[model samples]
Every structure is written in C-alpha cells, then in structure tokens.
Target: MDLPAPDRLAEVLRQRFGLDAFRPGQQAAIEALFAHRRLLCIQPTGYGKSLLYQLPATLLPGLTLVISPLLALVRDQVGQLGARFDIPAASINSDQDDDENARAMAGATEGRVKILFVSPERLDNLEAWRFLLGLPIDLVVVDEAHCISTWGHDFRPSYRQIVRAVRTLAERRPSVRVLGLTATANARTEADIARQLAPDEATPLRVMRAAMDRPNLSLATVEAAGAPAKLAWLERFVAQSPGNGVLYCATRDQTAIVAGYLAQRGLEVAAYHAGLDPAAKRRLQREFLDGRWRAIAATNALGMGIDKSDLRFIVHVDVPGSITAYYQEVGRAGRDGLPARGVLLYDPADRRIQTHFIRSAQPTPEDFERVLAVIAPDADGAWPNLTRIRVRSGLHPTRVTVVLAELREQGHVEKVLIDRKQVYRRVQGTDTPLDLTRYTRQDAVRRAELDAMIRYAEGAVPCLMQALRRALGDDDAPACGRCDRCAPPAWADLPPVEANEGVAGWLLHRDVEIAGSRRPPMSAGLALLDGQLRAPPFIDFMRRRTQPGASLAPAVIDLLRRQLDALARRHTFEAVLPLPSRTWAQRDAVAALAAEHLGVPWGADALAWRDAPDARQGELLNNDQRRQNVRGRMGAALPGATEGALLLLDDYVGSGATLAEAARAVRVAGHGGDVVPLTIAKVRWRLGARGIV
Candidate 1:
C-alpha cells in the first residue's frame, strides 16, 4: 500500500473533505493506517475521528469495510461521505431493506463503493460473510472500537467476532489494514482492543492517544433526592437554558416520564429509546438536528451518530453505569467549542438501576446451560427452530440472541440457514466448557465501573474533568479551572427545587401499559413495589391491607375510577372479575372496588385457580416459564356474558402471563365478550424483562 504523498493528500483533503489541514492527531492516525500498522485511535468526541477512515477510504484502492455498532452511526457516516464529499459510500444494516443491502454489497463487489459500513451483528450473518468474502476489502474500520473490548463499559458480544472476521478477511487480502476508533477507552480497554485486533505480535499495533480534556463544558452534580425534586430541577433548568440539549435517562420508561414532564411544562421535547421504531428514532434525530426540538429525553441509544454541535446542555436524570459512558454522552455537548453544561442529578439510590443493568448483561452459567440444552440436535439430525429454542429454553428473545451468539463464538454452536430460516446447530462432539472466568472478570470490571461513576457523582473527586480523564486512562490530566470543583457555576447555587401539583400528578397518576397485551393491559400504577424514583404510595398502602370489603385510599380509588371511566367511555362493562390469586388476598377487594366504582356487578368468584401455581409469576425467569406455570391452572366461573365486556382485574401484572392465562380461561368457557385485563401496577425492568404475547 503506497502512502499518498503530502501534496496529493493535501489536494484530496482540500477537494474531497474541504478541510485545509488535519485535526491534531488525524494526520498521524491516517499515516499509520497507510503504513499498514494495526491502529487504535482514542480521541474525545467531536475530534473528527471519522475523517481518519473517510479520508483513507477515499484514497485507498479497495473497499473500506467499516464495522460500526449503531445503525444511526453507519447511516450518518454514509450520508456524510456521499453528500459532503460525493464519495461513493453505502451501508448495509437491519434498518435498510434487503434490496438496498444487496445493492450496497453489489456495489462493493463491483469496486464502485469506496466505503461500506455495516454493524457487527450484520457481520454475524452467513450471507453477509459470503458477500464480504468476495469483496476486495482493503481496510476494516471498527468504529466505536471500545465495544470490542470486554474491559470497556459497553462491551458487546457481537463485537468479539469482528477480530475473527478481520483475520479471515486478511487471509484473502493479506495487505488489509485495520483501524479501531473510539472516544472512550481506558487503559485496560485499550490494551484489550489492541490484543484482540492484533493477536499476532509480528504485526505490532500502534496506539495514538490525543488530549481528551474539554474546557468549554462545565461539569457538576446536583443533589436531587427524589423523582419530583429531580423533575422540578429539570423543568427549571431547561426553561433557563437556551439551546437544544439532551436529557439522558437510565431506562426507556424514564425517558417518557421526563419528556412528559418537560413537554407538559410547555417545552418542545421528545423521548428517544431503542424501543421506538426505526423511523421514529430517525425522525427525532433529524428534527433535533434541524433545531426543531428544544431538547430530547433519551437513553444511550441516542448517543451515537448525533452530529449537532450547538447543544448547550446535557443533563442526566440517572447516573450512567460508568464514567466512560458519562464522558462519551456528555461529550456530545460543547462540540462547537461554545459554553455548555453537563449536570448529573445525583441520588444514591440510582445506583441500584445501574447495578441491575450490569448483572443482567452477564448471563449466568445456568442461563447458558438452559439455552444449550434446547439447541441440541433433533432425531432427524437437525437443530430445533429458533422459536422453539426460545420457548423451550424459557429465555427472553434478546437473551437467547446473546447466548446463541456466545455459543457460536465458543464453537459449541453454529448458525446455518435451512429452508431460508436461520437457526443454530450444535457443533458435533464439541466439549468446550463455558468460559466462567471471563464472565466473572467482566462482571467485576462492570461493577467497578459503576462504583467509579458513583464516586464521581458523589463529588468525591475534586476535579470533574480530571476524574473523567483519569478514568479514561489519562493519569496525569490537569484539572479544568472551569469545573464546579475549581469554579462553581452559577447554576450550582440555585435554590432547592420545590415539588408542585404537576410534579405530584406526573409521578402518581401516570399509568403504565401492561406491555405484551393483545389489548395492551392498563395499569393504574407504575409498580406495585416502590423503587428509588417511582413511588405510587396508593399501591403500597392497598397491597399491605385489603380485605374483600376494605375501604380504599382516595388516590387509589380515584385512579381506579379514572381508568374505569375511560374504559366505560370506550366500551361497556357487564361484570368485573378478579383474576384469582392464591397468595395475594387484595385482588378481590380491588376488583370489587373497581366494579362498584364503574357501577358494574362484582363477580368475585368469576375466575378460580384450578391449582396453586408452583411459584409466583415474578419468581419465574422468562416468559415461557411464567406462561407454563399458569397454563391450564386457571378455570373461569363466568356465566355467559352475551352483551358487554368482562373486566378482568389483578392487583399487579409482571410477566403478564397470569392475566393472559385467566383471560384465555374465560374465552375457553365460551364467554363471547371482550375481556379487558387491568392491573393496579405493571412491572418494569431496565433489562432482562419482556412481555408475553
């Protein structure tokens, strides 16, 4: 590979990228790639890391296959490459149609496309591998390369296969150049990335580290004890701020909650998460970039591919799992070198949410074995269907995907397309033991990262930027004189936020949709149990002491009445039936109250448990297990309700299998009426929880 002369490089930079000169470390990184050395470039956000590959792809002879993590990032890069520079670039991802992906691959094979971006998950596909094998791949760029390392805060199992893919590609194209780029990589993460990218010491990897301190952004943590207080702070803060910003939340539900509070306050804000459809996410991103939105309350899903530079603030309603995530996310702000602020609304209990995220991501040995047991080949010498594996293993679809990928990587399983359907097949005579040590170490690293984040949020570190820099492997980073520790910002001195009726209503009255319902079950409360942020006290009070005729709290009764009124407006109800529960005695009382409130007959014995469930719904690990636990275990006592709908009520809905089973029982009893499932509280989790359809 001939290195482009400085004059030609300058000409290409001027003509194609419209840049006079490279950013501080960009030229060196580009030169290293041309020198055919394995490269890992760790620079802060907004440092133009994309230029390293974009420029090289322009000059490189063969295809530059960029393995990106997020589809948004891939699309943004491809768009910029084509629109700004008129570069022949394209991307293949899940978001794209099959025909589009096919054209992109065809373009690469025909040597028309210079840069082709794809996700690591896309690389895992056998069809994609065949396409890649045929292309004359010159460069492999691992964007957001920190994900390839287990030591990184956001380690993805799919990324682990990229190294092998690159190695295989190298076998055909021996002169292939590799570059790994990311904004956040600590010492361990960087080392892991280097080791994984360049396993053989013969071709040494070059490390380029740039100064990561950002002085234009102010950092601080404000103590907001509860959801109401935090929300009040957000409301006041957003009103005072001028430019578009991002309010980061821990979960998808919180995004809606925070965005609702802000929007209700007459601010133009929208919530963003992975749960939203692809088009919705794209619309939000485009609108935010077009300066149509004042702010966006989003999860980390909105972190990548965001190019807006005038963001004035970045607020965290919940503490992120690590300093790496915090720095990368907050780094999105002040990219235009203007004054911006990043604030973490601090509360100690928020750590529980982060802890749960860490634990859930690391599947246990039992989880692996359960998935393994289901993937064993059938008598016809074929593996079970993917859906069968999911059902028989009793793992959530997402978990099954992760475990299957890991199993494939460990050589215990492989994906083969049969009858145009992708399914996992057991590797014959493979006796590879589960890599428990690696899993254990990864869990430790994640927990430690969470602890570091907590310490930073608690103000244990004197200089916020210095702490962040050191956490990202900068040991000798000097303190930014503009931080709160050095110079407390004016906003830090604001008075305590007072909770108002709006905040109280947003916290208390917001209903949770029982997810995975055929009719989308309605719930009056967020959860029957209280967490650090959500506190619907009415639920707690009623669950503790409620008999068949117990008087209900006004808040609880008001909420139930409101839900019932809404249902009545939509459809008439003939009877209210309490889904039978052996443990919780409050369901009949709650249902009876609901029936009385709605002026409907209370059928206390309409639903009966044929036998006691082996365990509570919450005790079950996955959807299939929960469904099986209640299957054929409930019998309905409903007399033929020929005219109006039947209101089936429960105190709490968690996997939602119990209510579904009970509804099925009523339907099986030949009741020709709509059975609407309603619950007092709907269970929500940050991870490892999904609804059963």
Candidate 2:
C-alpha cells in the first residue's frame, strides 16, 4: 500500500489546504496514512496531529473516520479541516441533536463528508457499528490515543473499546488503515497504547515520534504556605506577568476561588470548568481566546481542544496526578515557538487531594453487585435491558455502562438485543464471580505515580524539565536549562501562610421556607443528587433506614442529631410531628429519636401516606415526575397553635410533594402558626413556580 504519488499528495496540500509543506514528522505520518499503515504517532502538541489524516483524506476516495475523546476536540478539528480544505466535515457526539447526527451520517453515506468525527464511546452501540460498516471508511484515526492505555494518566475505558470498532471495520474494509495520535506518551504508555489500538492487525505497526523537548517553555514550582497566601501569590504572579495565560486547577471550586481572587484585584479573569453548561464553557473559552479576559482559571477540561499558538503561560494551582497529564497541560503554552512559563504552586497538603481523586475513581465490588442486582431476568430467563433497568436502579447511566463492561469482561454476563435495545444478563450456568482485583492493582500504580508527581512539584531534581522527562521514562530527555530550576525567578520567596488561610467552615444556619403553601417548612440532607438510584452508602442507607430490622450508620445518626439540634436552636421548636413512613416501622427515622433527645414531645403518626404508588422516588428523572411520585400521598394531623414553630419531620424529603400536601392537610385541619419541616436527608424537591429542584 502506497500513497498517491508525491506530486499528487503535495498538490492537494498546496491547492486545497493553502499549505505546501508538512512539519517535521507530519509528512511521514501523511504518507503512512495513505499507505494504510498501522501507525502510532506520538507527536508533541502543536505539531499538527490533526493535519496528518486531514491531508490524506483529500487524496483518498472514501471517508476518514476519527474517534475523538472530547466534543471540543472534534469541533475544533472539524472546523480547521473545513476551513482549510473547504470540504464537507461533520461530527456526531452525545451533545448533538438527532437530526444533526443523522445529517452527519447521511453525509458520510453519500460520500460528501471526507472526514467524520465520532465519540469513542459510540463503539458501545452495535447499531451504530453496523451502520458505519456500510460506509466506505478507508482510514480510522483514534485521536488522543493515550486514553486507550489504562496505565496512561488520562485513561478512558471508552477509548479502549474503539479498538474493537476499528478491528470490526478493518474486517469489512481490509485496507482501512488505523492511526492513533497523542501528544503525551512515555515508553511504557506508548507500548500499551500501540498494543490496544490495533491488537488484531496482521501488519506490524510503525510509530512516529517527534522530540519530547520544547525549548521555549520554562517550569517553576512555588511553595505557598496555605490557601490565602496561595491566593495572594496567584494575584501577584499574574500582576507581574506579561501576556494572557490559563491557571490550571484540579477542581472547579478551586478555579472559582482563584478566579475570584484575581478578579477582586481588578484583573480581567473568568472561571472555566466542565460542570458548566456547554454554552457557558463555549462562551468563556471564546472570551479568553478573544483577549477579553487576562486569564481563565480552569480544570484539566480546558487542556485538550484549545489550540492557542501564543499562550504565554500555563500555571497550576494544585499538582496533577501524573507526569504525562502534567506535560499535556503545559504543552498548550509556547506553541508559537516563543518562550512560555508553566508554574506550579503547592502546599505539601495538596497531595492529599490528588490521592483522594485517584482513590475515588476505582469502583468497589459493592457498586458492581448493587447495579447488577437491579436488572431482573425477563420471561424465558433473558437479561433485562439497561434503559428500563436505569429507572429501577438509581445509578448514573455511565456508571451502569462501566459496571456492565466490567461484568462482561469477567465472563459473568453477556449482552443481547431485545427488540433492538441492548440488554444484559448473567452468562448461563458459568456462575463466574465478578473480579475487582484489577482495580486494586491499578490503584496501587496510580498512587506511586502520584508520589512521582509530588516529587516533581517538590523539585527533587535540579532541573524541572529533566525531572519530568525522567519521570515519564524519557531516558534521553535533556535538561532544558531554561526553567526556574536552572535560574530562580526574581520573587522566589512567597509570603508566609496567613493565620486564617482557609475559608471559614459553613454552618447549618438556614431555614427552609415553602411559599404559597400551608406545609411546614423543611430541612433535608446535606446535598441534593439527580433523582436517580445510586449505590450504597446512598441507596444502601436509604433501604436500611426505611426498612424494618436494619441498623443505621453511626455517622448518619450523628448528622441527623446535629441538624435537629441546630434547627431546634434556630427556631426553638416545642413539639415534633414525624411524617408517617409508608410502613409503621421505619427503623432508620431519626426524627422521633432526635426530638426525644431534645426533650420535645413527638408523635410518629402526625403525617400519613394516603395510598402512594409502589415505585420508589429514585425512579423519577426530574421534578415533575418526582411531584407525581408522592402527590396526595400524605395527610397531616392538626395541633393547637403555639408561639414557637411546629416541626414536621421525615427521614428523607423528596420533591416536597408529601410535605406540601401534608401542610395542606394540617391547614385544612385548622392548625395555625409557622409549620417547620425537617428531614434527615433532603432529596430532590421542586418548589412551585420555580425550577429549583
């Protein structure tokens, strides 16, 4: 397999893309792309990874399919390709509308789209895979290919599955070349990535790698005593800096804090994180790029898709988990071959946060079993579908997908199509138990990597660049001699930690008021979750507390007691009326016990359910369905008016329909005075005429 003659490829590059040359290794990559080569390209950032396949697709007759990890990346690459060659370029992602996705697929089918971007997770859809099989796809590029390696710091299991889709496509279209591109990969990660991308290919893979060193970039580590001092130093750093930059944070909360600090100091800045709605993210990204803001404080979510050539700096408020991830984040800087600085500010305590994140990512065995238990076998003993099972089980759809994938790999389950929807069930008679030891093994490896990252931040070696390179297993990586380690900055000594460096603790100080209704005001759980069933200690606590003969956690009891004491002190409640449980025995209801502790007389039957539905509250998606779940399902008994507010209590208050209806019942029963409502946990509750659920 060979590319179209050099003249032909060169002509398309010049005439269509307005470019007559390929950067260093890009030409070899483009030639490989045309040769149907099984290629692994470990190029540095801004080396034009997108153009490798984009250029070859123009010379080919069929579609060049791309599996990218993020929607932003797909959008940017597609936009660039369209602008350069003026061809039909489209992408399908989770965020796109049905018609949009259909149009993209239609373009591919009609041979109008030369390049199509797809989310890596699309491989999970058998139907989508089958549909893509009909297209004349000559090249499949797994962009951000490092994500396929579990050992890689940015590992995504979905990216690992793209290999299967590539293999299937290769089976149908034998000449379909597979190209995996990533800016960050060490020797170990590179091997792992290569093995995962085209494991079944008969042709041996060729790897194209550019030098890892970026000469114009400088690195520094700042040791701030604490949070307040850190904020002060951050303001100082930006004040003294020359051009616009991005400050990387490990979490969105940190981003807000840092962004606010800089804004308060009269610096133009904005916060960006993944939690924001798509429009907000897009707006902030554009604003910063357009030079409206001096800096944008963000989490790693801003790293991959952005392609600013002259981004003078990339600073980190907290240490990242691995050298690979750190390199990728800093690579955004100095893309125009000018000097840029990557600074890391940290306290020794910051390591704990990264450790917590690494630990939290590994799911427990209980999580697996809890999700699997919800999918009941259907008639003829077939496995149940996941969509219907989601409503029954209060878990995120992603969590379910991850768990199912794990189960399938363990040989404990199999997937089948029932009426065109994907379903899963236990593999018959094999009775293989689910294994979670691999997660434990991975956790150990990640912890070691975190230690390595900590060492890098601590400046364990003289040169930061060389230290990072060595940590990533780049033995030949040279010392840049341009970073702070080579020559310290002018203001090296940061201010000491402020006495009150941390923010003040948040107190349980608020009173819940429901307007336009006669219901008692409410108290609820510390946080609200999307109305869905999640595993224990969430659902586990719920079931144990609501059911008879099940004991409660000491922490749950303590939290309820603290809330009750706080509310009593705030409102000076005299009498307590407990919302009646669906059953007489709600062993977990702490309202009765807490009121007794407060020496306030309590009645368990003050509010009663009036023939509620059997379905649990977790099955509902939003406030509307939630209100219906407990509508007209409760009645409140009347009590004489008292000076202090009366307390109406339930173990868990969801949607407030039961409580609101009970308040109506109490009003109808001729009780007056402010009705106070309290629940051990406040689940999602919709207030009337407002969308605060």
Candidate 3:
C-alpha cells in the first residue's frame, strides 16, 4: 500500500469532501492507514475523524468496512456519504427490510460499494460474519472504538468481537489495516482499547491524539438545591439564551419533564430518547438541525454522530456517570470555533441517578440462571422467543439482554436467525461456568469514575476545562481562562433563580398514565422515576404510607385528591373500590378519600382475597409467578349487575399483574362497565424489598 501523493490528496479533499486542507492530524492518521499500520485516534467530538477513513477509501483499492455501535449513526452516516460526498456507500442493519439488506449485500459483492457500514451486533450473525469475511476488505474502522474496552464509559459487549473479525481478514490479506476512533478515553481507557485492537501481541497500535483544549468554550458549574431549583434555573437560562441548544437529562422521564416544562413556558422544545418511534426521532432531529426548534431535551442517545456545528449551548440537568461522559456531551458545543457555553446545574442528589444506573447494570449470578432456564429449546433444538423468556423470567428486558450477551460471549450459548428473527441455542455439551470477576472489577471502576465526576463537579481543581482535559489524558492542557473558576462569571455567586410558582408546583406534582393489563385499559399515578433513580421523598412516601397499618400521609392524600379532581374533569365514575391488599387501613383511608371526593358510594369489601399467600407481589420475579399467585384467589362481591365506570385504587402499580387479576374478578362478578385504575405511583421496574421506585 503506497501513500497518495500530497497533491493528489489535496485534490480529492477539495473536490470530494468540499474542504481546502486537512485538519491537524487527519493526514497523519490517513498516512498510518495507508502504510497498513494499526492506529488509534483520540480527538474531540467535532474533529473530522470520519475523513481519515472516508478519504482513504476513495484512493484505496478495496472496501472500507465501518463497524459502528449505533444504528442511528450508521444510518445517518451512510445517507451522508452518498448524498453529500457522492461516495458509493451502503449499510446493513436490523432496521432495514430484507430487500434493503439484500441490495446492500449484493452491491458490496458487485464492487459497486466502496464503503460499507454495519453495526457491531451484525457480526454475531453467522451469515453476516461470513459475508464480511469474504469481502475484499482493505481498511477496517471501529467508530467509538472505546466501547471495545470495559474501562470505557460506554462499553458494548459486541465490540469485543471485532478483533476476531479483523484477525480473520488479515490472515487472508496481510494489507488489511485497522483504525479505532473515540472522543472520550482517559489514559487507562486508551491503553485498554489499544491492547484490544492490536492485530497481534508484538505489534503496538500507533496512538495519535491531538491537544483537547477548546479555548472558545466556557465551562461553569452552578449549584441548585433540587429538581425544582434546577428546573427554575434551566427555564431562565434557556429562555434568555440566544441560539439553538440541547438540554441533557439522566433519564427518559426527566427528558419529558424538562422538555414539557420549557415548552409550556413558550420554548420550542421536544424530548428525544430511545423510546421514541423512528419517525418521530427523525422528524425531531431534522427540525432541530434546521433550527425550527430552540432545543432538544434528550438522554445520551443523542450524543454520537450528531454533526451540527453551530450549537450555542449544552446544559446538563443532572450529573453524568463519569467525567468522560460529561466531557463528551459538553464537547457538542463550540464546534464552529465560536464562543459557546456549557453549564451544569449540579445538586448533590443528582448523583443518585448515576448510582442507580451503575447498580442496575450489574446483574447477580442468580439472575443469569433464571434467564437461562427460560430459554429452553424446542423439538428442533431451537430456543424460544426472547419476549417469552422475558415474561417467564420476570426480569427487566435490559437485564435479559445483558445476560444473553454475556452468555454468548463466553461461548455457553450461540445465536442464529430462524425465519429472519434471532434465536439462541445452547452450545452442545459446553457447561461454561459463570465468571463474575469481571463484573466486580467493572463495578469498582465505575464507582471510582463516579466519585471523580462528583469531585470535578464540586471544584476539585482551579480550572474546569483544564481538569476535564487532564482527566481525558491531556496532561499538558492549559487553563482556558474563560471558565467560571479561571475568570469567574458575574452571576457565579448569584442567588438561586426563582421559579414560577405554578411551574414549580407542576414539576413536583405531574401525573402519569400507567399501562394496565386488562379491563381498565389505563391507570393513573403521581410522577415517579420508572426505575431506582427516585427522590428520597418518593421512596419515603411509598415505604411509610403503604405499610401494613399506615395511612396515606396528609400531603399524599392532598396530592391524590387533586389528581382525582383532574381525572373527574375527564370521565365520570359511579363508585370507588379499593383493590384488595393486606394493608387494610391504608386501603380504607384511600377508599374514604376517593368516595368523598367523587361523592359516590364506597364499594367496601367489593374485592376480597380468597386464599392467596401473604407474599408481596413485588417479591415475585416474573409475570408468570405474579399472575399465578393472584389468579382465582380474589373474589369480587359487587352489587349484582353493577354498571358505570369504577375507580380501582391501589398504593402502587409495578407489573399490573395483580390489577389484571382484580379486573378479571370484577368482570366475572357481572360488572359491565369500565374499571379505571388510580394509584399513588407507577413503577417502571419491580421494586425490591428495600429499593426505591
């Protein structure tokens, strides 16, 4: 492989990429690839790392295979390559139809495709793997390559398989070159990535990292007491900011909460997260890019592959899990070498959200066995549907996914497509023991990273940007002198921004419609995080007021009373029935309040437990066990031929399995009207005996 002449490289750069000259380090990285050297490039977010491979594929002899971790990023890049640069590129991903994927494959085989983008998960498919191995691959690019190392903030299990694929390619053609790229890798993470991406043990990966100091950006950390104060400051800041921006939230629910609050206050904003449909996400991204929306309130799902250059601001409503994640997110600002600002509305309580995420990611060994047990093979030795496994095992869908990925990576299980859908099968006679040592090590590393992030937020150093750059392995990074610490902003010591009373009240008392199992069709509850990232007040409310003999707190009763008053405006209820529970006093209190609020009769003893055990519903692992525990054990004693909608009240709703059984009992007893559920909170995941919502 020969390096392109300097003149020829400039000619292609100008004509194909619409650029006059290469950014610093771009040419060097391209040269390393041309010489068939394994390289790892670490630069800031706006750096043109893509051109290192995209430009080379134009002059190279063979295909450039880009293995990325994000489906949205691959789709976005593939579209840009052909539309913007006139490069013949295609992508093969699960999001595409069979015809689309087949066309991509066929195009690659016919030598019409110069660059092919595929996701890391695609390598797990045997057919896709063999097809890639058969291609005439000259350059292999691993975008977001830090995901290959557990030490990285966003580690993906599928990325670890790329080395095997690259090794196979090099075994056939010694000219195959590998390039690994990331924007957020500390010294330790960089070493891990370099070690994993090397072609062989004797070969060292050529590391190329530009200076990470961004002088045009100003960094500041503002202290807010809680969510309400944070929301207040966010509202005031975003309202006064001049240009387009992004507001980062730690959870999907927070995205909606923050976005809705801003939108109600006359800001053109929308929420973006993984839960959104593809069409909505596409529309929102297009609108944001076109400057039709002022800002996007989003989770980290919007981080990688966003190419907007003129974003004026980036705000964090909650603390991120690590300094790497925080730096990567804030780097989205000041891309155009213009003065831009990044602010963190920090509260000590924000750390709870990141802590919850770390705890949830670590599944116990028993969780692995429970998930494995449900993946039984049929007569043909094919595994069952994963949806069934999730329901049967009663674990969170994400937990099941992690367990399966680990099982497959360790060679205890194998994945294959049956009728274009993925199914797993156990490796014959291979009893691979669970190795949890890695989980322990990873947990310790994550906690330490979080602690470092907290220290950074609390001003452990004099310069914010300098501290961030140093954390990302740039020891020589000088102080920017424009941040709050370097040159304190005028408002650095100002009092907390006061919020609109109505907005503050709404923030603390928003309502949610919980998905129900049957009959009710829908349920209602107070705002609470779906997972473990809940406020201490919410945890205390659920624990203290839902005890065996406790009653709803006065504030809780008032909140529920106000919630029902709003629900009354939507639909009319004939009577109120408290769902059967061992906490009789609380149920009675709620029934009295609801009955009084609606001016309707209380269906006392309308639902009674027959012979169900005393085990709590949250203690059960899966829907199957929970449903069976309550099935046929509750009898409804409603008036004969009862009519009209009935309000079913409970303390909380997790799986809604118990509620479904109660609804069935009501139907079986000749009630022939709607049954709407109302509760204090709606849980996203199953609550442990002492865990938060």
Q: Candidate 3, residues 551-610: lDDT per residue as tens digits?
A: 666666777888788777766788888887775447787788789989999887898888
> Which stretches of model 2 miss by more than 4 angstroms?
199-202, 365-367, 378-401, 416-420, 431-437, 489-693
Q: Write the per-residue lDDT of candidate 2 for residues 465-529, one digit (tens) a residue.
A: 88777666668777777777787753264333343333211111122222223124333223211
Better of 1 and 2 by TM-score: 1
Output the better candidate (1/3) by TM-score: 1
Answer with 1 or 2, whichever has the higher lDDT: 1
Could you report the Cα RMSD, in angstroms, for every candidate shown? 5.1, 10.1, 5.8
lDDT of 1 by residue, 573-659 (tens): 888888776656666667767788888888878788888788766655576667778888888876664557787787766666787
lDDT for each of the candidates?
0.79, 0.70, 0.79
Q: What TM-score would every model get versus the actual structure? A: 0.83, 0.72, 0.79
- On the 0 to 100 scale, the lDDT of residue 279 in model 1 is 72
Clashing pairs in 1: none
**In model 1, how large is the Cα lDDT of residue 56?**
86
The global Cα lDDT (0 to 1) of model 3 is 0.79
What 10-residue stretch in candidate 1 is worst by lDDT? 521-530
